[model samples]
Target chain A: MNLYRAHVLICGGAGCLSSGCKAVLDKFNTELKAHNLQDEINVVETGCIGTCDLGPVMVVYPEGIFYQKVAPEDVTEIIEEHLIKGRYVTRLLYERPASGEQIPFYNEINFFRKQQRIALRNVGLINPEVIEEYIAQDGYLALGKVLSTYTPEQVIQVLKDSGLRGRGGAGFPTGLKWEFTKNAPGDQKYVICNADEGDPGAFMDRSVLEGDPHSVIEAMTIAGYAVGANQGYIYVRAEYPLAVQRLEDAIKKAHEFGMLGENIFGTGFSFDLEIRVGAGAFVCGEETALLASIEGKRGEPRPKPPFPASQGLWGKPTLINNVETFANIPVIINRGADWFKQIGTEKSKGTKVFALAGKVNNTGLVEVPMGTTLREVIFELGGGIPNHKRFKAAQTGGPSGGCLTEKDLDQPMDYESLVAAGSMMGSGGLIVMDEDNCMVDVARFFLEFTQDESCGKCTPCRVGTKRMLEILTKITQGKGEEKDLELLEELATSIKATALCGLGQSAPNPVLSTIRNFRDEYLAHIREKRCPAKVCRALLQYSISSELCKGCGLCARNCPENAISGEPKKPYTIDQEKCIKCGNCLDKCPFNAITLK
Target chain B: MAKANCPLPTSNLSEILDKYKQSPGSLLEILREAQAINGYLSREVLQLIAEELGIPESKVYGVATFYSLFKTTPTGQYIIRICESAPCHIRGAQDVLATIEKTLGIKPGETTPDGKFSLEFTSCLGLCGVAPAMMINDQVFGNLTGDRVREIINSF
Candidate 1:
């Protein structure tokens, strides 16, 4: 390969692609050709560069100049000034949101500084569409080594020594799950990759699949070797089209390269994988439900302990792992168990990927070491809460997780630590909430999600979560009695205890965690009939401030309800009865005349 | 590469089993190909696959229904998947959903009377920032407003 003078790698992940990274890359290529520097300068499209909010991000390697929010038009200047003249585009460089300092290197940004990428190790570094790129980066090496070198027992033993647990919510030991399937009495066994991530604010699984499809393929192959399974299925949601497309492409290339089909790498271990598209069901994230879906049944949960490992798909022992968990297998195999063990805390060894979203400044995918504090992820890496809003709470683990307030900011991010902080490491979805967010509304939101996603197989999850949501809705609307809160707790506990699958078991977490940490907010909503955050629509009353309302008809004209009855150029009085409280008038009012009481 | 052509809706279970008896893990592949031809995995297909693979129909049915991707019923002309995933939910997807329901006058997971649209809620469409998003047919519309949703629906 001829060495180019420079490589301009642009982020081609979903975030940047939507933000016009493809146009930016095309323009860069055109400009490079026009400038006759095509031979010298090469433009490449890589996976996610993590700082998704500041996309169409580009990194000029060798110099490693980090550019944010680049447009197609900016490509000319970049080629003219940076590429041709060898002068840095200072204006295009990423400026610190707080200090306004120029950030030169991509890693120097707070978003990337704290993250320790392991599952996302190859993301943003390689072209996901190509197999050789994945191969060159030690992609299928682990599967090759495991099939050729290690016995099924030895492979499981190595995984056990590595201390690798499932990153897919449950935190069960990956090695133990493999062992169960391996030891089970069955002539035919199966391996499955659970890519049907149903969590809100979670994209870690999708990112791994989109950025490194081969990793999952290799991991599943290794899993097949360990569990003595000849076949595997990847149950990915059909919503993830890009990830699905990339995975299909990767699998085809793998088969063509003789990596996936019979006698792989010249070994006798034969394994192959096929993609199973999920038809938009959240309950399918549960292992049993997932297996049921793969078997062409309605996506619903079943009782475990005849767990998937003992009698999974078609009554055959099956070992199932999520995308992120599979991404870690090759790394754990390449680097010895002890080396992988040293990165994280004692129990939670190895890094975890989080889809950092919500009120944070830099919203994207982040992978941090297990012991890293929540404060670091929020402040240093997340670039603090946006719009100078005071940090109120952070919701982790999606619907299955809980809320953590300021008091728990210092808590480490490992599976146990998050659980200890009234949250679980449920698929690593970290949604930051500012002071303006209503705790009551937040709880109701999660309850509604769980209620909608419940497979309706078990009574507790099917009925219990709905009752809890009803109480929450009543409370948010200022129609709740004091006993409703107590009833909520009682119902939550019952549902948690009686639920059949993990979905039902963890559904009460958000409600339980919110009540535990923000009990006062609930009391205010129930007793004072007031939403502290002023978010509850029914609790809010739109009032025209006599001091500020200049009788500007803007408020009256814009009101969808025609509640502002005051005459133009005179003092305005908002009729409380007719006010719908949509906030349109408040937003349109120039003098800040309208207030929500 | 020779495409293995099995009998359409195989009648005899034992004969089907004998044909694919040597191939390991032939159950899912044979069933999928069979379903692809038949539009839906019928009981006859299940029984045929089970007998050919020396397994029971109950076992085949169990595997067929284990995954969400497989469908036993026939689908409509266009599948309109509204992402009820977390990000979309936060962006007032519930409101968008209400608008869709009122406009189409059909709840989610239901096909319209004309069979033009089959509405369903998916987990995530991978377009979070453009929240409150949905995919009508195969085209994805992000940062959805009720009006935009209506426009997309009308177009379909």
Candidate 2:
């Protein structure tokens, strides 16, 4: 392939796709053809560029000119000005959030500058839809090496030496699990990919799978070679339609290339893969429960010890790993164990992929070396809190993780560090909370998720989480008692101890962590019947301030509950009992007269 | 104990296994084809697969159920799925369900009105952002308010 004069790379990930990246790609192609630069300029649709806030993002390679928030209208100017004249489009260049300096290079942005891409190395660089693009980049070379050269034991040893732990919440030794499956007494063993990502504001696995599916396929094949498994299943949620489609396509191409299937590389080792669409069951994330669901039963987790590695599926050994974990496998094999081990902290090696979302200026996927501080991830990489709002907390590990307050901002983000700081790295979902977020409401929101997703398989998870949710609910509603905080802590500990599965076991993390860090906020809610953020609706009363009220009647007319009851020109009084606290009246109040007390 | 029913001939099973051995992502297709030939994906079929592939029965069963499209249990004629995503909830899908109960008088996860439809609530139908979506035998209906639900049911 001849090197083109210029390579125009467009972000093809979900965020950019939703923002019409495909249209941008099409326009680029059309404009190139129109300008007679089709042969000179190559338009390539790549994976996520990570600056999702300014998408659909595009980059001109060789020169590395980064363009932000490009639309269909801006395509002509880009082609005419930059492509024709070799001049950069200053308007399209990303302006630094704080400094307002136009950044030309993609790597110069704070978001990319702080990130250490290991698992997400291939994303935004390769066209995920093409198989050869992946293979050319040494995609399945690790699996090839493992299959032909190393034994299963050697592969496991390499993984162990790499210090690669599970990125899927528990941070258990990935090699140890593979070793267990290898040693387990089973004529049949399986490799399962846990892509049923249920965490809110988390899409790291989905992004990886969508961006570089061959990495996962290669890793799984290597896993199959290591664990003596012939078949692999990817239990992806049906919601990730694009990721699923790409995976399916990749698997087909892999078979066509003789990379997968019987006698792969003529070594007499056979492995086949299949995509299994999950019906959005959060409990199916648990390996045992995932196995049961794959067996055509209700998705519910069973007890461990006879772990999935020992007696999984229909009663055979099964090895399950998340997409991000699998994405890291090939790199570990190719780069060598010591190379990976050198990247992160002594305990946690390599990089972690986080879905940076919620009140952050740069809301996208970020991969950083394990021991990177939360402050760096938030203020530096994430471009600080949105709207100049003061950062209150950052919620990690989704519903199963905890809230980290401003004081804990300097804490290093790793398996041990997060756990020591009263939070576990639960699937690398980092939701930044600004001053606008209510601590009690935040706890309640997570509790609501856990409560709904609870499989009802265990007493503690089912009943205890519900009870905790009730306490959180009561506190948010200003009906909480002074003893409710004590009750919450007690119930949280009990739930953590007594829950059968990991789902239940970590269910109380949000509550426990929030209460530990934001105890004063809870006290204010219970004691003073006040929400410091004024977010809790029940504790707030919407009153039309006499001075600000021009009696526009917007509030009274838009009031769904008909709570506001005064003449048009006079100051309105909201009937507290009639107000359902929906905030419609307050939203519709044009004069800003409606004040929440 | 009664002898376990063997669903497929050993020779046919071996051939099927050999055909898919070199095929990547042939697991689901093979299982579906095997089930079509044998009425269901039986333990005997799975065991034969294990023996041929040098894997275990538990692993086979695990792969089968992980994908929602693959059914281990035999289903009735039609699958009536209800959308239970956020938008559907906001549009009073619960009340629409209650009406379904009153009309057919059957709860979700049950076959009703002469076993023609098996009602099961599913996640967002992609139309969500647009409320109250439900699928009946692969046909999707969206923007269903509570009152319009009965009309939909009657049409089905």
Task: Looking at model 2 chain A, report the run of 10 residues with the lowest lDDT sum.
Answer: A13-22
TM per candidate: 0.87, 0.82
lDDT of residue A331 for candidate 2: 93
Worst 10 residues of 1 chain A by lDDT: A291-300
lDDT of each residue in A1-597, candidate 1, tens digit only: 767989898888877765668789888888888888989987878877777778888899788889988999899998888888889888888877778788888778878777788899889888888888898898888888888889899999989999999998889999999999999998999999999887888888888888889999999999998999999999988678778899999999999999998999888779999888776678888888887677656667778688889999888999999899999999999988989999999899998888877777777888988888889888888888877889998899988899888999998889888888889888988888888788888889888888877877789998999989989999998999999988999999999999998888889989989999998999999999999988898999888788888887887888778887777788788788888777878899899877887
Per-residue lDDT of A449 in model 2: 70
Return the lDDT, model 2, position A541: 78
- For model 2, how does the per-residue alpha-carbon lDDT over A1-597 read when each residue is reduced to its tens digit? 767888999988766765568888998899889888898988888877776667789989788899988998999999889988889999999887888888898878878878888888889889998888898898889988998899999999999999899988889999998999999997999999998877765678878888889999999999999999999999988666688888999999999999999889888999999888775577888888878767655677888888888898678899999989999999999999989999988798889988776677777888999989999998888888767889888888877888788888888889999988888798987877777778888788777777878878789998899888888998898899999989998998888899999888888888888888988999999999999987787898777798998877888888878888888787888888898776777778778888778
Error of 1 at A280 (Å): 0.8
Total colliding residue pairs, candidate 1:
22
DockQ (CA atoms), all models: 0.21, 0.06
> Which candidate should be chosen as best, given lDDT against the real structure?
1
